[model samples]
Target: MMKIIYTLFSCLIFTSCFNIERNCNDYKTGTFQFNYMEDGVEKTGKFVRTEAYSIDYFEGKIDSSSVRWINDCEFILTNLHPKSNQEKRSIHMKIISTSKNSYTFEYKYAVKEGNRPDRVVKGIAKKIE
Candidate 1:
């Protein structure tokens, strides 16, 4: 019995399967910041969640287009208008684990292929007044 239960638990964790009510209430609704490592360099940014579904980002002499939430933890960023064939890409962020004031998140864009196709973004955000 113990062996069977352990095997099932291992399978679930390794499969990246999440089934929890991490609703909008659990996510912070205010300004936050994160440092991203891109191209072997680090970039810092300040992000704001105006409401449950709206966002704006700025930091380190850089500001980005508005972002909006699609679901509880998922968000879409439109950096550019509908120019040519691309209409801007979407970024999906999910809370993999959390404490009271912080959460571990993973981010990825919907794409076909590349090295590290699934890039995990570990961010720690704090709520502000």
Candidate 2:
């Protein structure tokens, strides 16, 4: 029993020491491609981001957003021209992890609406240029 406990403790210690690499600065301003599901279809979208702005091309529509960096790994994105009530809400995004040419992110509404629960979505984006 003591040997088993020691082995389990050693495993836990090693696992807890593992960390995900994140180099957010490399992705701060670049062109990126993301693949996601929309209406039962998998689609790819591209976006170009500068320090303070981002332009997204999706579904043949070009939309722009203003970006405010909260930190090196997080930012708030507000649509420049919202067409609907849902679009008016700003999104808060954080870089969860990153690899050599890609990063994983999680995003959700920046401001909660009434009693509605906030929904967070995660995706991976690859830097294209």
Candidate 3:
């Protein structure tokens, strides 16, 4: 029993020390492709991001958003020209993990409204340029 407990503790310590790679700065300003499912259809969107702004091209329309970085791994994005009430809300985004050419991120509305619960969506983006 003592040996088993020691082995389990050692495993936990080793796993805790492992960290995911996050070279966020390298992804701060780039063109990237994100694939998602919408209405049961797989869709791809491309976006160009700078330090302060981002332009997204999706479904034959271009939308722009202003970006404010809270840190190297997190930021908030506000739509520049929102056509609906929901679009006017700011989105909070965080990079959960990263790789050589892609990063996994989660985003949600920054502010809760009405009785709707906050919803977080996670996706992976691949750098294209």
Of 1 and 3, the candidate ranking higher by lDDT: 3
Backbone clash tally (model 2): 0
Q: In terms of TM-score, how similar is model 2 to the real structure?
A: 0.89
State how far residue 7 of model 1 sits from its true place (Å): 9.5
Per-prediction TM-score to the true structure, in the order listed: 0.55, 0.89, 0.88
TM-score head-to-head 1 vs 2, winner: 2
Candidate 2: the clashing residue pairs are none
Error of 2 at 14 (Å): 3.4
- Pairs of residues clashing in candidate 3: none
Off by over 4 Å in 2: 1-12, 15-17
* Best prediction by lDDT: 2
lDDT tens digits, residue span 1-129, model 1: 999999999998977765543544566466665677778988766666654343445444443445566666666655534443443655666666655655567776655344755765667665553
